[model samples]
Target: MNTGAVVRLTEATGVGRAVVGGKAAVLAELSVAGFAVPAGFVVTGAAPDDPELGGWMAEEAARLGGPRFAVRSSAAAEDLPDASYAGLYETRLDVPADRLAAAVRECFAAADSPRVADYRRNRGGDAAAMAVLVQVMVDAVAAGVAFTAHPLTGDRRQTVVTATQGFGEALVSGQAIGEEWLSTGHRATLSRRGPARVLTARQAEEVADLARLVAERYDGPQDVEWAIDRDGRLWLLQARPMTALPPPVSWAVPGPGLWMRNFRLGEWLPEPGTPLFATWLLPLLEAGYLDGMQATVGVRVPFRWTLVNGWYYNAPPVPSAALLVRVLRDGRRRAVTILFHALVQVGRDPAAADRAVLSALDRQWREQELPRYRRLVTVAAAEDPAADPRRLAEIVDQLGRHAGIALWYLAIVGGSAWKMEACLTRFARRHLAEVLPDADGGAQILLRGLSGAAPAFDAHAVLSADWYHPVAAELPTITAVTQSGDDRQSALAVARTAAEQRCAAALADRPRRLAQFETLLRVTQRYTVIREQQARTFTLAWPVLRRCARRLGQHLAEIGAISAIDDVFFCTRPELDTTATTDHAALTSAVAERREQWERQRRIAAPLTLGHPPRLIGDVIERTVQRARPAGTTAEHGSEVIVGHPASAGQATGPVRIITDPRDFPTFAGGDVLVARATAPAWTPLFARAAAVVTDGGTLAAHASLVAREYGIPAVVGTGNATSRLHSGQRVTVNGTDGTVTVHP
Candidate 1:
């Protein structure tokens, strides 16, 4: 345990947990159990002579031979009976012996990270002593992660093993590539096998046995990391308890054949009698109002993109098994942000609200009235003169276009840093799916056939003018109304008033908005029935539909189909098909010449269009909509409730940061307010340095909350956009009281 000294994993014992750490202990235990544990050494609690322990570890690694080795962290408390620090540490795979010391030091540094320190602190464990286990890297035929019980369901007597090609690190961190298995009993095995990274029956049995052995030896339910070496020998690397599951909630028993559904009605409903508004009047000059464009116009445009990119990575690798899992794990922050932004913006953006209403109505009609044909779906009585169905439909289309623009902006901005293709494809597909119905389940059919030898369907011919014709018809109307007003403020007012009137009128006859909501639900059911009936025939429709929509959008761009003539021209296809009389090159030259002339004209008109209030409004809306939402808590004060998330678990008074994006990160000083949407692993660095971590979305295990607990700081999560609710630099007391973030000035 001296400085620069190391211990082999084979020689270490469970008692070594004090000096060598848990990783080496596990390796020792596994070696004695006759597992194919690799040869490695442990750098005990002693700090090495080299300033950078990892650099020293790398030097020692060279002595052992330079090809491949695993430098893993072995904390005293990690992989114990409680709390598995699975992703909280570091491991370097395929490291050369020459770089072993450096890799080991890296793991040592990670073990002392704020997040890791916080993790240990929360568990009431010492964070001082850490052991590093360096094992000779195995040439694996397969690698995976296994659990004695269903980690997700807490179903014991079941073992889940997920295997993939490559090192065991991916499997341990849930980033494994390829086929997987969910096995039951000590002997039973379940696997899905195929030529493309599929699991065979024999391998399934072997994997199940491996899981069972780890569980049995661990003396309790355990999560195990393992690999099958090139010779088909299964090797157990590490094992620990699963701490992510929570106790099941108790609920009232329902009567036979009847089940009640619970919905967050409060979220959708406006606060009683017009919620309190805290308005900050900015300097008229600071507002920087564009000529002919109202200041409020930008505010009404939903800036959904900003929040969504909280999870956006720049330049992601190809979508492999490992990458997908990584995305899923890391992207949770983004997903939550997206959902929050959409919901919050719906309350703020008139255009978004209108679209949501239309979507609800369309869903209702499809699920209820269309299927039965005999029963007409209920409609609201309050019909505003301006809330025309045609107009609303057009508004929805315009909203979709703006949303697409936001995605485009994010993709291009981060194109150099992360993979933009997945983001683009995901956004495009999702937007398209929302508007298009699955007549024959065609979209799914097409996607499934993408990797197969499916026939080359004429997507434009099959999809256009038929399946999506109705939706397309609404787009023109959307375009027309979207640009009807000069600025965002006026356009929003127009859309909002129309929507309000319609909803109000619809509720008038029913005496309650709830009744109208019920009608909408019925319509949604009818629509689903109709779709079920149509699915049998339109199974191959989506590919064609998507192709047609893409082409149509492109065509629209060519013909200046939308108001932004310059933008449309920039997006157009280069060549247009012509009749027999035109020569190829000559015709191309003529078209190019005309395009240049049009470009010149458009440039002159650019400022005119840009100056229009609605166009300027679009720009501002994008900015606001993209901002991140921070957590907050609510405390009843007279007739008002102040809500904000408690960053530290306890109660303390402090000023809030009200951070809405990365741009605000620098403004935070130690112990200042750390308000934001949900925090991800990447955001943990800030958590250690922040006074408290308040977020708009999360539960106890949320990234910010977890770090806060480690640091013994007060943390409050799920404050429902505390950053927006509380003004920046507002002094408040955050009480992480009974899991609620109460804000008190």
Candidate 2:
């Protein structure tokens, strides 16, 4: 029974699941479920070199009508709901009949590989229980992998297909790029990247349709491999539950006007917001923004926002005659900062506004606005979060407004850093280009700030710096280097002093421009420090908010309405509002469903913008200023190069150390090239030890850019696909001067 047992694929029943393993059993179930599955046989409890197995395999291959066979391992540890050992075991494709035994042996032997051993140790229950599946290899002209849900965006309404001209191994192994097709309601669109069209529109739909059926059979979203043969007949090869899927979220733009996520408040929120955050904190923050606007600009833009796919998308209503009239009527006495901002917006001279706005707003913020916010946070945080709903709501509202006003203060007034830096850049490009070797990136050196560490690096002040807020470990990380702050401070002072001496020489003959240049450089440096100082405290109110949310969750869980304390985050505001009277079972089910959707949303590669794009104040300044538009790409050394925005000005060569999850922070070593999709405020400490910084997403003024500048490391930001193109341990030369990341092949 152990050496010679062999079973026909068509005859293997669902009852044979334990005997044959998940992969083989699923294929048999798919056949019974009327899905198109290629005929295959399972060698159950038999050695690959068995004498009877050789005769049985030869007989089955002849009966199966195959010019070639595929030998795949069906280990018991594979394709389980809890774990999917994808690509860990061997799958020998296009095997000849004579070599089938060898392929089978290889498949069986792969169970002992180090990769699988490591995986087993981590996941456990990997007992090397395996059954080899030998099947007739279909003559595929095109092949691909399909996800019943949009894997990247966690959009359950959309199915994604990655197809190629031949075997799917190329696409899966990253050896070749494929045509990315997205199907929504029978209509499909292909991505502009990758090769020419491989799958016809109808073929992609067919693949998606089959994938949906597979998901339906499995009662969850499925990752399925499929192939379309020369005759256009489709065959299902394998199916498994999609692993680590983000929570499902909708992408449809809510209401009208332009909407974006990575700007404004969205910049700090890198992942989908939980229900409580979206409902309670977001509105309060928005209100605070309105307050900041009123205080600084004395006008309202009537900005509104909503959660699209669990991410905030704010929209400033497009201006009409009516909107303009309302704004004029609503306008208060414009603060000095806003008055200066208007001058820049209209392309007028801003020398006068610059001097007044910078001094006036800074004094006003330090004296009145900041103190008020500090008072609000200090007072409210001291309150009991477990108080009655009304008191808790009031406390939440007060904290939210305080935090939001902090953002507008930075955007409206502290934002002068951008203008000041541009002024310095234009001056350098026109006057100091001959003196400064790297003219395009000269502004970075000038804006390294006056201090090494600002209040922005304080972990105690910004709890949301971790992104996961309540969930992240409280153990301090990245901020420990404050003890050696003097070294970092001295580095900045030296860089600034050197750049200034060069600039002073360039400004010698021209008294008018020279005086103006000094003013711009000083403010640019000061504002660089100011930006982080404000950013560090932008989420100061988050701790109190989290406590309130957890307190509510604890109450709900204790009453058996939700499964866990954190499940309260998944319930919508209205649902939570009515929780006092709502049915416990209904609320419980809603939390479970929504929690899964929120988790799935984390995987989506959210677009930078949605709806129509709007021109903002920063765009106006760029148009008015004579600036150096640095080149993003250049060929060098025949290596893979990634083009991005030049952030920090320095150069360093080292192996890449990509940190995606906060848990991976401990794995990082000193002097490595820090690679990430983006870095948050809490990620600043790593920059102290980093040789260079490379991010998939960010701008010159973003958190990563600001921190990298403070540490004086080479940085390339906004290389949209760097995380996928670059991997850990790869040697790379980061050229911050040119804004390029070059891989050493």
Candidate whose TM-score is highest: 2
TM-score for candidate 2: 0.74
Q: Each candidate's TM vs. the true structure?
A: 0.36, 0.74
Which residue segments of model 1 deviate by more than 4 Å?
1-4, 50-67, 121-126, 174-177, 186-195, 246-745
Looking at candidate 1, the ten consecutive residues that score lowest on lDDT are 273-282
Clashing pairs in 2: 152-604, 153-604, 246-599, 246-600, 246-601, 247-597, 247-599, 247-600, 247-601, 248-597
Tens digits of lDDT, candidate 2, 416-438: 55555666666677777766556
lDDT of 1 at 429: 34
Candidate 2 overall lDDT versus native = 0.71
